[model samples]
Target chain A: MTTSTLTHLQTLEAEAIHIMREVVAEFRNPVMLYSVGKDSSVMLHLARKAFHPGPLPFSLLHVDTGFKFREMYEFRDWITKEVGAKLIVYRNEEAIKQGAHPLKLGVARCCGALKTKALLDALEAGGFDAAMGGARRDEERSRAKERIFSFRDEFGQWDPKSQRPELWDLYNCRMHEGESIRVFPISNWTEMDIWQYIRQENIPIVPLYYAKERMMVKRGAMLIPADDAGNLKPGEVPEPVMCRYRTLGCSPCTGAVYSSANSIEEIVAESAIATRSERETRIIDHGSNSMEDKKKEGYF
Target chain B: MNTLDKELFSAVETALLRFTTAGSVDDGKSTLIGRLLVDTKGVFEDQLDAAMGVEDKKGAKGAHLALLTDGLQAEREQGITIDVAYRYFATPKRKFIIADTPGHEQYTRNMVTGASTAHLAIILIDARKGVLTQSRRHAYISRLLGIPHIVVAINKMDLVDYSETVFKQIRQDFTDFYTNLGLIGGELTFIPMSALEGDMVVTRGTQLPWYQGQTLLEKLETAPVTGKINARDFRFPVQYVSRPQTEELHDFRGYMGRIESGSVKVGDHVTVLPSGLTSHIKEIVTFDGSLQRAFAPMSVTLTLTDERDISRGDMITHSNNLPRVEKELSAMLCWMHETPLTPGKKYLIKHASTTIKAMVTSLDERVDINSLEHIAAPIELKMNEIGRVSLKLLKPIACDAYANNRATGGFIVIDDFTNMTVGAGMIQ
Candidate 1:
């Protein structure tokens, strides 16, 4: 049979694998940031394919924000055991001790303390030189301009104006001792691409992505899960609704959309005609430059 | 609601085209991209509503389209893009990745970075400006970067009264300038467009009845890609070695890497460079399944029939066709650092999968951007300056000319102290 040219998905997969190998080859100690989301699921699948026969050389790092949905924790543990690689789960113990929740301290302070600050502290403690993320350019406006092998200073700050000129696949991974690099292997894959690849590879994802009848509380324009009824205010009621989350984040900061897309195929089709971006469901990204600011402060 | 149809899923498997846009700061490059995204239905309704609500800072009417591409906070505040922001949009026929580069003269390095991997480049020429120096400069850089296809779009025709005479004159001038650059053929095309009015970009908006040609989107959808790289000699730079070292697979050793160019198959005779050892492809392995053959850009593991002494940085090629193994060579180098590149400076030259210490022997000549003149024997190169330089590597590395196979031809120069990529080179 005559060989055929590769489809876009095939090409993207190849490029992503090539990038993963390059990171392992160049960096001293690398780690994969596993968020247990769909994008992370796809990244983990590619990582396994990138180095077959041989076990994974790098460990998976999960910065647990303590406020995530309970299902996410279960999936993370199950997948970590199946991958058979070392898993490092770091949480902000001080914040948890101080009872710092999104509702109490506000969204900005809560994310900054639990997610961003905790991530930096974990990387420093582990002495990791390279951290890999599953961030895609199509996710947000700021990410659309980031490099594949993004450089960060000793403080883990991202300078948007002074990025290195990345050319072709020749990623420049050299940096000072105090500085580090954040490599994104799936930087080119869009949301639809992630779902399609997940379906194609039969990769397992968290159950929260599909719609089901669940107890939800109405908050302004969003449907928040009624995980804890004690946090409700006056005139608030917990009710069952057919809803699904387009993204997975802190339970208080992530909202679910009303939909009946229970399967991967339906989600793919719904994404095709969806009027709002997936990030619209992210409550913390209200300001136009919120993501950019958080990134500068070392948020993944 | 649109359900998952067979045809819509097939669109996900279509060909992908990667291109870049180039023009002066005032040439509406961003506006053209916005128009493309809007017409292709790539923009979401929320994004449109937000754009329409942006506080018309510059008082440009109707949704400051330029704001769409300037994603950085500083760029928005300063009202000028400073880096290469990538954008994605697709039609049912093809998917596109647009590297939207800044047009300021100071940001030439960003433009070069954007154009390095592009299969095609759209050189925008403002119809009223009529092919200024910036237009010619952009065209020159696109040609230098070896972009296979070029579309010279005469933009803002609405401001020029949709004059056919202006469009023809600009096209003729651009052709003359490009012909003078020693590259000529069917690769160059021209399209008269008004991005603000949305003419001849995604659709033929009935403005230019005299001009019967493919719209910009049509040409982009149909442009050839990947064939340009796959047509060259087979080059595979080994990136890593995979060894299971387990009881079940104690003797398994696989060379892992992507096919930089050309194709490879089982039972094919190949040779490892720098060692001159011969081997036959025993098995082509992938997680999906084993294959009889694989082409360029596919990342696969190949276990050779013979256990040759091979490691990372060593190249594998067909036994008959080979690359030049040399220590001293000349290349067109683009300086990307603020510090001047003095002659006789030693730096790290990363080529293919190997990094070696290299020294610049001499600055042969610097190509003046404005006039395309070669200034002989320049002492040093400044930021964003393009020049020809001779380099001597400590170890001999296999290389192909940049024009032949871009995968193996390009290299980046790294500074020793800062460890940043300071220069980009294309072997001559």
Candidate 2:
């Protein structure tokens, strides 16, 4: 922290903390959506700070796709224990049993089935009126104009066109009986900011971010782990390669890039010089498709 | 070829700056944002491909840069921005959040939403058309919202043959009009550029060698943020009172909220507003540790020496210094709902964690944005109209001028029955 001034990370942190405090104060049942990523770590930290000297009022909700990196789960459990917060994990097991993996069902269909559907189901089951997502405006073009308190209807549909006017610090927590609001605290934070903040706060993220000698394979244009979750198509081959992930999602769907950066400072310096966009490595956001479609289907 | 050094770029400043773009639809607000985002490399390749694909299908000339900002499906179908879309980008110098509000005259309420939290407002103008009514209206609204800085961008310079004379004339007209409008304070800068030809946006173009000013990006990077850093009297609007009577940390009474203004250290004499109960700050608590001093915008818990019954809606400030407490408030209300704001109508007014039932006593005057004249004795204000309205609150509210501090003075009106936000109010 600067002596008298706040850096951009601190500013974003303050804004997010303010939002979280508002959520717990206004909403009936608010949950913080934890994806066990760097953004989620920063978000959890801010949420903790939002209500200090006392236990956090909200529970952590992780929409389990059942195909995450093994290290991510372990790290998440450890963090939950350390923070002494209850985590309510949700999943759509029926869809997974029906072969709803990304490789089998394709990008939108599979993400809609496992990620988006699971979240909507979880919200319905938990009766949560408000949810906090680590959704940043700089992450995707479609999210650029999303309201901080984005409204979702009974069917969990997000209409980017018709959103409440969030003026100044006044966020509308007034939702209908079944409707909910998806609030993003880190809406202004960029990828670099997340990495920088992680380094500053020493946020313990998954090991997949740092380059290591791990089992890997090539899929079309992306480098994926050889452990394909039993959905490897015909003619696919497995091999060992040194790589790291720019983003972490399901193992089969998330692409890994070749890198040597291992520490937070190294990754920050490397990511700063990296030319391609962070989402360029993810297959779901590839092609002519945008995340707005998935968001409209309630993909937090 | 103005590529900043890699080392300089890597040591990027994390200071954030938020600004709003305002103008009429044809003034190219969207195009300007797209150009800035694209030039800053904020747009990914795939996103650019989608926008280019849309342009190709339309057989449009150039890259159709506005597609980058007009993101929603309806916005694409109508070729207009309907909501306030936030766009983000960063230079090695700073990160920027752009409140890209719709430029249509009907969306002035949305413009207020975008500009209310903004530190600066970039009012775009078509050099060929000079300062139009919509341009003046946007500038007036931004000023009313207390945006500390203003940038009058004379856009579409390419269409006017890159004429310096046209840029100067528009700048002079805006200065004269704004001075008449009494928006004389704050820093005002003018620039001539084309969002299409990329004359003086992110990079300087050879076509505008006569325009000897920094590019828009440079001006934004160098704009002073220190003015807002000055400390004021302490004012912390109570968001919640935490009493986590636990085993180890018993009697942990704390008032939680982000400081609206000023700084507070331990042992400072403070008064809870509307209550005026005197106390001293005992501790400033955060998740990480205790803070010796906390400043504005920092969300922290402040424990007082006395356990006063402070709950939400009560504000804490310096004992000697207090904001004006009143029941009747005169403010500029930007009508947001379709139902016209009628006098003697009851609504819920929410301001700084305080929600109270209030009635619109009278509409003193409505401004004709086009003519800059006040329509006296207006019965009601329709959607997107700005009017001076007096509100009688059921309970007194402690507030500073919206110009003095937006966090304490800005408010919204919700319809009593529908709960829809009907208006955005700035206390005069």
Candidate 3:
């Protein structure tokens, strides 16, 4: 490899590592928000690399919406076991008991209460001063304006118009009492980069990402995976089909694509040629301004 | 991968650069990013499949490379970047993080956010549209943000028949404007390319035979970005105080911070700012081990020989090369909020690692972007406008001229009531 090329890679890695270290040093009670998605998996892997001879200094915080795919749980458990990091699952049992499914209360409200609010409650309960997320700027419009060290008020609200100027990587993680920051080390990474890194690093992921024979039902333009957690309407019928998920969210909200790419290499190849965005495949974002509205309410 | 590949990957992983692309709409910034990714072979098969499907569904011709960057549904439907989209790509040479910022005037705040940490700025200009007001504004902002390098990409050459005359004319126009703005410093390179046709993006196109210059990818790979941080002034904003009461290492007191500028070594005499306390650097600690010397941008904990009252928000610097410590300061400010910055309004001012209450004393002059004229006696600084302002701090701050040190010279104003960032100011 050319010296310049090697230098460039070194620079990116160093910057990311520095940011990760800052997250650990700045926040008093910090936690890593693990979603078991490809980005989070990569984040977990990078966290391990950031502190090489030792275990991660912070615990993993997962806001379980209670409607997640079984594969996600398996992946989450497996990662926690492998990393030996403390895993704290935050779930709003009240919302689940209230029958706040996607069909009943809509994807936005369900996610707001079950996922975003649950995470906020967890942070409050645990007195977490900072939470590290795998949110990339390329994901959405509101996300693009996010700072590496995004400050949240006591209410865990994100004010897009009034974001701190994070010049020269000198991030100000200082916040008032009861306030916190949402740190993103991979804010610069895109979807393609994530896939490429996953392929190159050979990071372990959930099997739901790979195509397999699963019971599915066509809904609108998406292929909805039929699972025990997903409730079927009167007109909906499940059929056996080969499918895989581009993004993992709630089982009912996350849609599957018709494909046969089972391996990491195959997934990378398919990702290059896929027409829809990873978010587009997810049924949860079908609502108008769902993701944006969720983010405003302190969702990562 | 072999052992050599593993080593190379490790090295590349260690060194990464974040850059932002800025310009007015129709400058082909998105297309340029698409070309970069496609040319570098960063686009995987799944992504390609999705792009092809979108192209087919929309009945659009060409590759629709912009789709790769326009990730949002609204952005795709509108055919304009509504936000700052970050795209990452890695070649065998280097890994890059590209902040693809929107070119619209309304999203100026987004541009600032993206360019905040960028080492370089790729300012795109449509060859047809010589030098627009927005282009000038972006260049000024890029310079104000203290990006080390600037690459002026003259895009859409195919629309102008790849004319050397057009490229030269545009370059001359930009050079004149930048000269007048006093913002064109560091290694500035001008490249002509057609982002739509992929000319001079990854590989030099044969069509531009007269333009004998490196391709966009080649230039990015070979660009000199080594001398970023100022080596004269050592500034470290203490983030935390690490005191392990463990058995193995009792009485271990280290001040942790990422080096913002310059370098620090063991036995170097350093002075803590704000308190004016002096001490010697006993050790430079890292996750791996202690280092003999640590430079800017490296996050390490420092063990001082003296047990001074050093804490977060306090800065440690070379005693001989101390920065100006004052309560009152002057800066060039950009108003980013809808609410105007009024004089005497108390706000929270955040510098490197410190946050203190501050109030605007006076609005010296407002800059008219189009005419590049200073409007004296402006009452309020509106959104997306630049002005010179004086501020009085409730507490003293140690800072340097932005031209000398970016880390110490910048600050952001936050509303005390709402706690929203209202404006960004650079010390003059």
- What are the chain A TM-scores for all the models, listed individually? 0.97, 0.95, 0.95
RMSD of 1: 1.9
Ordering by lDDT = 1, 2, 3
Provide the TM-score of the second chain in candidate 1: 0.96
Fnat per candidate, as a fraction, reads: 0.67, 0.65, 0.30
TM-score of 2: 0.95
lDDT of candidate 1 at residue B125, scale 0 to 100: 89
State the iRMSD of every prediction, in order shown. Answer: 1.4, 2.6, 5.3
Q: Write the per-residue lDDT of candidate 2 for residues B1-428, one digit (tens) a residue.
A: 12434453344545778899998778888788888987888776666766677436446533478877777766788777778878877887888888988878888888999998787889999888998888888888888888888999999999999998888888899899888987756788999999887779999988898888888999888886544533576679888888888997898899898887778889999888787788999999887899898997788889999878888999999887788889999999999988899999999988998889999999999998767699998988999999999999999988987777778889999886866778899899
Candidate 3 structure quality by residue, lDDT tens digits, B282-336: 9987655788987766667788998999887899999998989989999998888
Per-residue lDDT of candidate 1, residues A1-300 (tens digit): 344567778888999999999998899999999988999899899999999867888999999988889999999999989989789999999998999887788878888999999999999999999999999998778898899999999999998878888998898889988899999999888787788788778899999999999888888888988887544666889999999999999887888999999998888788877878888888777754388899998889
Pick the winner on DockQ between candidates 1 and 3. Answer: 1
Which model is ahead, 2 or 3, in terms of DockQ? Answer: 2
Residue B246 of model 1 has an lDDT of: 89
* RMSD of every prediction: 1.9, 2.8, 5.3
With candidate 2 superimposed using the best TM-score fit, by how many Å does residue A279's alpha carbon deviate from the native?
2.5
CA-lDDT, candidates in order: 0.87, 0.83, 0.78
Give the candidate number with the greatest TM-score: 1
Which ranking of candidates, highest TM-score first? 1, 2, 3
Highest lDDT, which number?
Answer: 1
